[model samples]
Target: MTIKKWFKSGSPWIWLNAGAIAISMIMVVGLLSLILVRGFSHFWPAPIVETTLTQPDGRQVQLLGELSRSQTLPAQVMREAGVDIPSDIDLVTRHLIKQGNRDVWGRDFVWYPETGMDEWRYPKEAMRLERREWGDFYGYPVRLKEEGRTVAEGEKLWPELQQRVDRANELFDEIRGIERGDIGAVNHRMERVRLEERRLDMDRRAGRIDRASMEEATVELEARRAELADEYAVLQQRLDQLYQDVRRDTLVGRVMDGREVEIPVGQIIRAVQPNDMSVVSKVGLYVAQFWDFLSGYPREANTEGGILPAIFGTVTMVFVMSIIVSPFGVLAAIYLREYARQGPLLRVIRISVYNLAGVPSIVFGVFGLGFFVYFVGGAVDQQFFPAALPSPTFGTPGLLWAALTLALLTLPVVIVATEEGLARIPSTIRHGSLALGATKAETLWKVVVPLATPAMMTGLILAIARAAGEVAPLMLVGVVKLAPTLPIDGHFPFIHLERKIMHLGFHIYDVGFQSPNVEAAQPLVYATAMTLVILIVMLNLTAISIRNRLREKYRSESD
Candidate 1:
């Protein structure tokens, strides 16, 4: 076709649209691939390299760690950074070595020019310890000691060390169970008793109860407190025993500098000789590490370990928000579409709803903080929990407040979707129902709503996708860097909506920006970002699946 004819026929625009879509799809896939490679590769066991680095001053130093990253730097840039780079060379190769004995060297990574590095070797006996604190340790195992006595050395030390490490981990689990389960329960009960006693005292002061009754209630609460204290004591005793057992064994490791350092068995999460591991062994270790990253609780300022709590909190908050927003949004849409008169006032209200959807999410967070927390929550605390005044149970940032705020923020989307769905139903159907002697309410309830279910789910899917990745609003409403306990637990009422929660979105922000160790935290940032994307996709897919099924069901019924 001629150019003018093509323009008039919109052929150019069609091609242009296709090109744009193709580019967008490519960009999305590329971004996801980058995240997957950078994030997932971190779990694989990389062989540790021993090298001698010659300094600009002609001093040689031993280096031991995994090769993290390599980059080409301009000679001028290297010179500007005070590194000795020859002017003859235009580009200098630099390597970022993850020399991960952070506790010994005070740094986890260091950049070295490739020119100064030589004598690279991989020692089979080289060890890497993933620890509970101070990051990873790179060294060679010298001996295994039990309670300061040498139990094994030389070739036999490796097997003995592995066995004792396993035993230490088992004891660690026992200690954690005692502390978080039995002891936690006792502490919770004791706090309840204390609150009850305070309530009784307040009632007495207000003359709401007789003095004798108040005294009896106080005595009973005190007895309950004493019983809980005894229970805690027993649990504490068991935890102490576990701690001793876990710490009884130690590994003497010789670091790159040839200094022997003793590490407690309890502090080591995993021990591996990467150089000696076969491909199969490395793959197995990768799977275990990846699983732990998904299921373990984060430690070390959220720079290490798994994000199970964040995952649970994100899903729980989204689930709760969906439940709260659905009925309210659907009902509002029904009223506006089926009941409200089409006039200037209705048009204005509709315009306002659309505007609300465009409002900044941070504004909604402020509103939630003021109206929901300070006003509603404060009132609840006053009326229902008068004795807990200063503490302000509900009058604080918590899981319920965050969910409610998100529900409010996404309500307009749901309303718009549902209204559009309702409008799509032919007017003839309503007239037919009316002619059949069905009331307006019956026709709307039985016929209109069922057919519109899919659209409602579409809105829910959008809401979940947006809310799951939202960080700013959640930060002000409820999300915390580290929540000591989950909102849901084996406590009275089961789900404590008043508790603060960890969210994957917030965790990403914290780890990426707020971490003290920038280089070490970089990979974790990508991993967490990837995790958030995956979570949002999963939630959206679930909603999409439900919507499709509902649409199919209604279509079949109509046929």
Candidate 2:
């Protein structure tokens, strides 16, 4: 076709649209690929290098670390930063090394100029200890001590140290179980008893109960307190024993500075001699570390450890939001589409709902904080949990408030989708149902709503995708840096809606912006961002699957 004829037929526009879509898809794929590469590689056991770094004063110092990153910068920038870069060089490449004995060096990473580093070595006996606190330790194993006595040294120490580390880990797990599981339960029960006693006192002062009944309730509460105390005592004894066992062995290691430091066995989460590891061993360790990252809790101001809590909180809050929003959103859509009169009033309401979708998310967060938390939650605390007054149960940022806030924020999306779905239903179907002796409500409820279910699910999918990645709204409503306990636990009201939760979106923000060690937390930021993307995709896929099934079922029925 001629150029003018092609333009008239809109052929160029078609090709242009296809090109734009292709470009968009490429960009998305590229972004995800970058996140996956940078995030997933963080778990790999990179070889630790022992090298000599020449300081600007011509003094050579031993350095031990894994290579973190490298960047090329202008020589002038280096000079401005007080680095002794040569004027002859226009550009200087600097390397960031993760010298992870943070407690010893007071820094987890250091930047060194490429020209100043030399004598690189990878020793098989060099050790990397992933600790429970103060970050990783890079050193050479010198000896193993039992209590205060030296039990193994030289070649005998490695195997003995491994065995002791395993034992210590086991004891640590047992101790954690006692502290968080058994002892936690006792503590919860004790708190409940205290609250009950307070409630009883309030009732007595209010004349809601007579003296005889008050005495009986007080006696029962006292008995419950005594039982919980006994349970706590036993758990405490077991916890003490486990702590002693875990602390019984120590590993003596020589750091890069050539100073011998003693690390208690309990403090070491994992010990690896990366240079000595075979390819198979390295791969195995990589998988294990990634799994731990997925299942463990954050440590070191959220720079180290796994983000299981954040994952759990994100999924749980989304689930709760779906529960809260689905029914209300569907009802509102139904009323607007099927019941409400079609007039200027309805048009204005529809316009308002559509406008709400464009409102800033942080605005919704502020509204939720004021209206939902301060007003509604404060009222709930006063009415339902007066015994815990001043302590504020629901009157704080928590899972329920976060879910409610998100549900409200995404309500417009759900209502619009559902209304569109309802509009698509053939009016003939409604007329036929009515002709078959069905009332208007019955025709709408059984037939129209069922056909619109798939669209409702579409709205839910959109809502979840948006809510899962929202950090600002969550921060104001519920999310915290670290929750000592998960919202869902073995405690009473197994789902603790009032407790604050950790979220993947908030985690990325905190690690990326709020962390004390920016270099150490950089990889974690990518990892957490990747996790949030995956979580949103997963939630959307699940909702999409349901919508597809519903569509298929309805199509078959119509056929």
Clashes of 1: 0
**Cα lDDT for residue 310, candidate 2:** 98
Each model's total of backbone clashes: 0, 0
TM-score of each prediction: 0.98, 0.97
> For candidate 2, lDDT tens digit of each residue in 495-515?
999999999999999999999
Off by over 4 Å in 2: 1-3
lDDT of 1 by residue, 1-559 (tens): 5878979999889999999999999999999999988888889899999999888788988999999999998889999999987668889889899998888999999998987788789999999999999999999999888899999999999888888888888888888788888888888888888788888878788889998888788788878888888888888888888887887888899999899999998899899999999999999999999999999999898989999999999999999999999999999999999999999999999999999999999999999999989999999999998888799999999999999999999999999999999999988888988999999999999998999999999989989998998989998889999999988889989999999999999998899899999988899989888888988999999999999999999999987
Error of 1 at 100 (Å): 1.0
> How far off is residue 537 in model 2, in Å?
1.4
Candidate 1, 449: how far from true, in Å?
0.7
